[model samples]
Target chain A: MADPLVIRGVSIDDTFAEAFPMRGARIILTAVNARWARIAAHTMTGFATSVIGCKCEAAIERELGPEDTPDGRPGVSVLFFTPDSASLQQRLIERVGQTILTCPTTACFDGLPDAPERMPVGKALRVFGDGYQSSKVFGGTRYWRIPVMEGEFLIQEDMGKVKGIGGGNFLILAETAEVALAAAEAAVEAMAGMPGVILPFPGGIVRSGSKVGAKRYKTMIASTNDAYAPTLRPITTSDLPDGVNSVQEIVLDGLDAPSISAAMRAGIDAACRLGVIRITAGNYGGKLGPHHFYLRQIMGQPTA
Target chain B: MTDRITITFDTLPSGGEGLELDGITPDRLLTLSNAEIAKLPVWMGRRSVPLGDIAAIQGELSAHLRFEGDLARAEGVGAGMASGVLDVTGSVGDGAGVAMRGGSLRIGGSAGMRLGAALPGASRGMLGGEIVVTGSVGAEAGAYARRGLIVVRGDVGDSAARGLIAGTLVVFGRVGADAGTGNKRGSIVVLGSTAVPPTYRFACVYRPTVLRVLFGYLRRAYSIPVADRFVAGRWKRYCGDISELGKGELLTWAEA
Candidate 1:
C-alpha cells in the first residue's frame, strides 16, 4: 500500500506531518453547571483568535464533568498558547482576569499538570480586588480566592506551560451542505470533550478558508482559499471534483501530536458516510506548522 | 534575578510624611526591558515616580531581585510585583510585599501589619513567591499567602500566618495569638510556644527533615543564624485548620 491513503478517490498525502514547539497552558474554568462553564470558557478564549494578532491563541479544549473538576463542579478546560512563556503568562492573566473572574462560580486550574515550566497567571490577576482576596492550597496546588460582590472567585497560583502543537486540521467535501454540515457536526461531536483536543471554531467548522497570503494585499498574511471554494471553480484553480458541491473543514489544536492525530482519525471515520464525497487536509506545503497528519496512514487500508 | 524592589517604611517620624522605599527591587526590574521598567509605578511620599526615578538599577536580564533598606513607612512596596524578590533591610510599613508572587523576598527586619497579606479586595496573598523575614512581623503576616514560603524569625503580632494555603512558613520566634486561623495546607513551624487555635489538633511530636533544609537555606542565603536546637529539636505536629482542608499542619518546637 502507498504511504498516503487515497479514500473515495481523494489523495491521502503520504508525507510525514511535521509539528512545532509552542508554549501552551490549559485553564480549567469551573462554574455552577455546564452553562456557566461554557460562559467562562468562551470569555476566556475570546479575543484569542491568533497569536499574530492577539498575541495568543486559545480555545475550549474540552468539557469536564463535576468529577473531572477540582471543585466538583461542571467545568471547561481551555487550551491557551503563545510563542513564549512570558507572553503566555501575561495573556493568561489578561484573559482569565477578564473572563473567569467575572463569571459566576468559576474556578480556574492549570490543565497541564506535568509540565515543568510554570507560568504565573492568577499571581498577576489577584490585584483586581486590591486586598480582600484569600487563597487555599489543595492537593499540592495553590488556588487564589478573589472576593467579588457575588461571592468568591478561585484561580490557580501557577499554571503549567508546555510545548504543544497547533493547527491540525482536515477537510470534508460532500454533495450538499447538509452532508458537509452533518459530517462536520458528527466529527465535532465525536471529538467534543476529548482530552487535550479543542475545536477552535464556531461549531468546529471553518467556512472561510485561506491560502498563504492575499493575492493583492502584500501585508495580508492570509486570504480566502478560493481554489477550494466551489463558487470560484470557474475562475480559480478549484480542487473540487465533478460531484463535490460543498465543503467544510475541522481545525484541531492539541497539547501533543498524537492527540490531534487520534481525534482526526475518529472525526474522519465518522465523517466518511453517505453524501460525503471526499476528505482532505490543509497545510503550508509542509513548511509552516511543524505537525503534519497524512490521512491514509492514520486509517488502516484494506488489503489488496 | 528578580527586579522588583521591596521598600519598607522605617518610621513615620510622628509628623514626617510616610517613608517610602522604592529602590530595592531585584527581579521585576531585571527582567523588564528598559522601556518596560520605565513604566512601572513606584511611590515617593504620596506622589508617583517611575522606577528609574529613585534607584540606580544594576544586573543583567533577570526576573528576580532583593531590596535592602529601612522601609517602615514605605507603602505598596512590591504592591503589584508580578514575579520577583523584595528583601527589606529594616521594618516595613503596612501592606509590605502585598500581592506579590513568582519570586522570593527576604526581609531582614520586622514587617509592619499585613505582611504578605491580601490586597484590600483580593482574596489571596503573595500568590507564588517566598517571603522570609528575619525579625518579628506585625499582625497578619502571611495572611492569605497562597502558594509560597513566608518565614518570620522573631515574635509576631496577633493573627500571624492566617488563611494560608499550601505554603510553608517557618517562625523561629513565638507566633502571636490566633495563628493559622483559617489555614488550609500551610506548614507553620513555631520555635516558641504557641497557643493552638481550636482548628488545630496535635498530630505527633517528631523532627521534620524539611526544617534542616530550611535552616540551611536561611543560613546560606540570608545569613540568619540557625540555632541547632530549633533545627534539630523535636517538633510537636498539630494537624489543624481542618476547618478548611484538614491538610495543613503546625509544627511547634517541643520543650527541649
Candidate 2:
C-alpha cells in the first residue's frame, strides 16, 4: 500500500469500499405517539441485518415530526434493502403487514413518494381488512384505511422503489480490541442521523467480517476474512500490519454511492482517534461491485 | 404573452334560459387567442351567439384564469375540465364544473343550482377535481360525484351530495334537508346541522383519520379556514341512505 496517507497521525490506506447495487424503499411509520412509532419501526427492522440469511436489510433512518408526515403525526422513517426489486417489495409488504399493522395507532406511508417505480405494499396488505378496507386519494396519491381492532390503520397504496447501493464497508485496524471498539463506537456516533445512509450492523460495527466464498467449505457463500483476523495472523497471509491486533468493519447501505462515501468519510474521520493504527476499506480488487468508495479521496486527501 | 386568461362580461342579463359556456375551459382556452375565444359559439336562449357579443375576453389562457361576470344563468361554465386553475370572480350558474376530470374551480360568489352536479341523465359528475365555493350554493351541489372534493365555505341548498358514489364534499356552513339522500358510497361532511333523512342511522361519534389529513390539506392548499376544532373535534357519523347501497356517510361536526 504505497505509503498510506495520514489523517491526524493515523495512516489512511489507499483502498476502496466495494458496493453492490441493491433495490430498496423508504417507508414512513407513524402513530399516535413517537414511542409506538419507534416500537413498530424497531420490530419491523429486527433480524433484518444481512440479505444473506435475513432476506433483507433494513434500519430506522430518522424520526419525523408531525408536520413532516402526511397524516400529521409522529413518524419514523425506515429503509429496506434487498437484492432485487421484487424481493424488496415482498419483504416490505411482509414486514409492514406483520409489524406496523399490528401495532396500536400506527400508520404507514410512503417515504419516497416522488420515485417513479412503485410497489403495491399497502395494496397487498389491504386484503387483511377483509373487504371492509377503504382507500382515499389526496394530492394524487391513494391511501388505504383498514379497520383494525384498535382503530383504523392507514397506509399508502404504494411505496416507491429506489435503486440503492449496499455492502459499502471500511475496516478499522487497531492495536487492541479496546481501541477498535472505542473507535468503532466513535465512528457510529459520528455517522448517526446522516440522511440517505444507514449502518446496518449491530451498533454500527461488525466483528466477524466476511470474505466472498469460503476456503474449506465450498458450499458456503461467504467466510471469515482470515486476513484481518488477529488469531489467524500467523497462519494466513495476514493483511494486518505489525502491531495491528484487532480489526472491526463498518458496513453501510445507502440510497446512492455518494451517500455512502459521505458517511464513510465522517465515520473514518471519527475513527482516526489515538491508538488507531490505520483506516482501510474492503474491496474485491474492484470486481465485485459497481460503486468504489476510495478511502483517501473520500477523506479529501490529495491523491498520489 | 399573457400568463393567464381572463374573460369578463361584467353583468349579463339575469334569468336567461341557458347561456352555456361548457366548451370554454382553462385547457381549451389556452390553445385559442383572444379573438378566437371571442368567436367561440355559446347558446343564448334560442339563438347561438359568438362569445364576443356578451363577454370581453383578454389575455391568453395559461396556468391561472379568471372569469368576471354575473353568470348565474350560465350553464356548464367549466364542464369536463381536465386541468389548470379557473377562478370565477363572480357567481356562476348550474353545472359550473359538471363532469370535470381534474384541476381546480374556485367561485368567489354564490352559485346557482346543480353546482358540480352530473348532466341531465349522466351517471357520474365531477370525476376528479376540486371545487371551492366561497358563497352559498343552490340545490344538488356535488350530486352523483364519482371522485373528487368540493369545499363550500357558505350554506348549501337542498340535496347536497345526493347519491354520491365515492368522493368527499365538505360544507363549512349549514346544509339543507336530504343531504346524501341516496348516496351509494361517499362522504358528505357538514359543519352544522342538516335535515337527516330517516333512511340514515347514527353510527358513531368519533374522529376520522382521513378528515384530519383532508382538513390539513384544505387549510394549506386552498387556504380554507378549517378550524382546529374541526380537525381535532369529534364527528357524528351517520351512515346512509340505507334505502340505497347503504355505504355512504354524512358526518356532522358534533357541537357537543
Candidate 3:
C-alpha cells in the first residue's frame, strides 16, 4: 500500500482517532486591554482540563482582535465542553462568575451568537447585583449590567450551545523525552489560532495519555495508557517501537469534524520533523465515536 | 413586479374626524393586487371610503410601502403592522404607529400626537418594532409602550413617555415638561435639553456600552445622522417614577 508513505523519516499510522459527541459553548471575554483579557480567560479555563474530574474541558480558543469582539475591545475566545448542555450551563455560570465577573474591566459576550440552542448564563449571575442589576437590549441582544466592586460588569443574557466533537488525539513517539516535547511544541504552534478547535492540555501537550478504564481498580473510569509506556515494556503489552523511549499526546476538541481534521493535518505535518520516530492515534475500536479521523487519509495517502 | 407600493394623495381629506387607515400597512398589502388594495376600506369622518377614492395607488406591494403627500388628517397610517417596511414621506395624524407589534415605520415629516403610543383601553403599546420620525411629534409619543424603539429627530410635546412599561425612546431634540412621569421600567434618552421631573433621583454619570451599539445600529440601519460626540459621550442617568415601580430611567447627554 504505497510502502506505508513516510514523511521526513516518520511513519504515519493508518489507524484513526475516535472522537465522541460533546456539548460545547464559546464565550468571548473582553477587557480594557489584552493582558487583562488574557488573565480572565486563563482563570476561567483553569481547573478545566478534562471532564473526567473537572466535569468540563475548556481552553482558550484564540486571542480575538477588537474588530472580532462585540464590544470592540481586546478579547479572548474560550471554548467549554461538557457531557451535556445542563452541565455545560452549570460550569459556564460558575467559571464566568468566579473569573470574568471578578476580573477588572472585563465583559463577557457569547461567541456563538447564531447557535439555536441558548443557555442563560448571565441571567443566572445577575442576581449577584441584588436589586441594582439593570438590563439593556442593543441590536436585539440583551445584556445585563451588574454593579460590581469595579464600575460595572456587562454580560450577554444568553450563551449559545452546540453539539461538538471531542477527544481527537494523536501520539507523538520519539527516541527521547526532549525530542517528544520539541515535537509536541511544534505541533501545538502549528495548530494554534485554528478556528473552532482547541487543545486543552497544558501547553497543548498531554504527558499522561489515558486508557478507557483502570487495570484493576473498578471505580476508576480511566487509567494511564500502559501500552505506550516505555517503562512498562516488559510487564504490559507494549505498543512502542524498539528505539522509542518517550511518547507525548496531543488531544484536540473541535466544533465539527472538518475543523478537527484540518487541525490534525497541521499538527501531524509539523510534528514529522527530526527525532520523531512515528505518529499514531488513540482509539477504542470504532464503536465509541462516530467521527474517525484516519491519519493516512488526512495526510492524502491511500489507506490499507 | 415592483418592490414598493406607492400611495399618493389625490385629494387631501379636510376634516377634524381624521381618517383611520389602519389596514394599509405594508404586510397587509404585500400579497394583494393593486385593484384589491384599492378596495380596502378606510374610515373617513364617520363614513367608510375606498382607499382608491382618496389616494392614487401605484406599483405592486413587496417589502416596502411608500406614502406620498401631506397626510396630516390621516390617522393610524401603520397601526398594528407586524412586519415589512412602511415609509411615509409626509406629515401624519395622531396614532401613527399605535399598538404596532413588529416591523419598522419611518416618517419623513412631522407627526401628530401619540406616535407609537398605546391605543385606548389597551394596557400596552408597541410590543416590538421600530419607529423613526424625522420631524417634530406631539404629546405622549411612546405612552405605555411595552417593548420597542422610537427615535425622534425633532422636538416632542409634554408627557412624552407617560406610564412607559418597558422600551426605549430617544429624542434628539428638546422635550417638553413631564417627560417620563410614571414610567415603570424603560429608558428615555434625551440627546437634547429636557426638563427633568422632581420625582427622578440623579444617578451616576457613565458611558454605557449599549449606547454605542445602539448608535452604531441607528447610523447603519436607518441612515440617521449620529453625531460622533454622542457615540463617545457620557450620559447622566436619572432613575424615577418612584411613585410607581421606580425602575424606569432617563439618560441625558452630559456633554457634546
Give me the candidate number with maximum lDDT.
Answer: 3
Displacement of the residue B174 alpha carbon in candidate 3, Å: 2.6
lDDT of 3 by residue, A1-304 (tens): 4568688999998899999999999999988889999999999998888889889999999999877777667899999999787999999999999988899888999989899999999999999999778787655788888877656799999999999999999999999999999999999999999999999999999999999989799999999999999999999999999999999999999988999999999999999989999999999999988889999988888788
lDDT of 2 by residue, A95-213 (tens): 99898889988888898978999999999999998877777776677878887776678888999999999999888999999999999999999988888888887888899999999
Task: Give DockQ per model, in order.
Answer: 0.02, 0.56, 0.36
Model 1 misses residue A1 by how many Å? 7.2
List residue ranges in candidate 1 displaced over 4 A: A1-20, A47-49, A52-54, A134-140, A301-304, B1-256
Rank by lDDT (best first): 3, 2, 1
Residue runs of model 2 more than 4 Å from their true location after superposition = A1-3, B14-18, B61-63
Structural similarity to truth (TM-score) of each candidate: 0.56, 0.95, 0.92
Go through the candidates in order and give the C-alpha RMSD of each one to the true structure: 15.0, 2.1, 2.6
Instruction: List, residue by residue over A221-295, the lDDT tens digit for candidate 1.
Output: 888888789988899888888878898988777788878888988888878778887787887787777667777
Q: List the residue pairs that clash in candidate 2.
A: none
